[model samples]
Target chain A: MSHKIKGGCQCGAVRYSTDAEPMVTFNCHCTHCQQASGAPFTTAVAVQRENMTISGDVIEHTQTSDLGTLVHRFSCAKCGAYVYGISDGFGATAVNAVTLDDASWVEPQMEVYVSSAQPWTHMDPALPKFDKLPPMEES
Target chain B: MSKKIEGGCLCGAVRYESDAEPLFAVNCHCRHCQMTSGSTHIPGIGLPAAAFSHTGDVTWYKIQNDRGGQSMRAFCPTCGTPIMGQIEGEEILFLHVITLDDPGGFAPQMDIFESSAQPWDRFDDTLPRFAKMPPMGE
Candidate 1:
């Protein structure tokens, strides 16, 4: 079903909305995800970059991924809430799932970078797991 | 085993170190956590503020919790990596566990604010669970 999802930063400085159904939803356990989120992993939903619109001042931090691709993380400057990310190797922008105004609906369909998952972190056995980001075509 | 742990933000704009072992560690699933870390939840270690030392440019954002308590979250201004959080009047600072140089060493003893956890997130049954922040001593 097609619907609009809304979210914003903690301080209400940044707001975003997307009407496109997510192409994929997944959890990432790569060390970069860990550092970027200050958590064991991060949950995100990927959508067509053209389908999303964001307002307010946000800053982007670019880092080279282990796969040799550049990933740009965007966050609210006022509250420092991570909003979304863009990867040079991927066509879609990944919005941090937790930033959704109503995140209860998010259900990760897969787990990626499982090889780097922390030993103590738990994962749903029911979801498909990958040692790394699956091929772009598969996603 | 006790060991000194050190870490910094992605842009290297902020750095911190702690010599004392974590007194308590937990995975917090509160909405506040989700907003701050932009993740399902945040893994944090409660450490004595006295034992922690930080350097570089850090920004603090104050937010009032649902309970009307004031919480201050600190992050690196340049990279936006959340470094730590502190509740007003509390002596311990909750350090973002994942920010540690050796984050793999972290072992969460419990899960807190499970009531706020997202449907997609799962927690280990092995850890103690609290629907909300337990009493200070509990």
Candidate 2:
């Protein structure tokens, strides 16, 4: 169960744990995610904001996502490891998927912003893809 | 011929420019990279130290690798971007290629630290793969 999800920043300056399973998982290929994550895509694990217990200080950077929604990204104040994010665009607090202590349980539900994905990025063909965001029923 | 490479963090709070050609490019699946990038691996380019410049704030987080060498992760504080990394005593700086002004420019030639790779990670299956860090001269 994803209930055991726990992780911290690379420097251990920020640590977090959540006892609840993620409600949604997405692989975002938007340029904003690409630049922010320094990877072709970001696997975002969405969970209830109240379910997480975080220790240590974190600084938030607010930015308008490519979809024109406000997404607040957070990084460890000292180490700069991206930890998690919050946005009105979605129902839950999104954790940077790999930031989990163990991400082997992750299986992205869908791929978004495929139009902005890096040419060399290899993705699983079995997963659904979208050129941009798909119609969503935000909780 | 040398070409200039330029890029920055997502929020435009940090910028960097390099005039030297990269020595190599690869995708690293080390656990540290996974933790930092929040992705499967790091698509980075190894560049020589000279003729590189950057502006704005960057936070560096240092960690000891499985090999026991210290490598520091450099990220933008304002935007939370994984900017680059450096191994202590090493002359090269590995910059995350996805942060480039033109993210389309990255051409990764290999994969490293595969022993720690996740099962869900998918690759093109064309590049050479190393179980761990590759011998530099090879």
The TM-score that candidate 2 achieves is 0.93
* Candidate 1's DockQ: 0.79
Model 1 Cα lDDT, one tens digit per residue, B36-58: 88888998998999999989988
How high is the lDDT of residue A69 in model 1?
74
Score residue A93 of candidate 2 by CA lDDT.
83
Q: How much is the lDDT of residue A27 in candidate 1? A: 94
| Chain A alone, TM-score per model | 0.91, 0.87
* Model 2 RMSD vs true structure: 2.0
Give me the runs in candidate 1 sitting further than 4 Å from their true place.
none
Cα deviation of B119, candidate 2, in Å: 1.1
For candidate 1, the TM-score is 0.95
In order, the interface RMSDs are 1.0, 1.4
**In model 2, which runs have C-alpha deviations exceeding 4 angstroms?**
none
TM per model?
A: 0.95, 0.93
Each candidate's fnat, listed in order, reads 0.74, 0.78
**Deviation in Å, model 2, residue B69 alpha carbon:** 2.0
True contacts kept of 2: 0.78
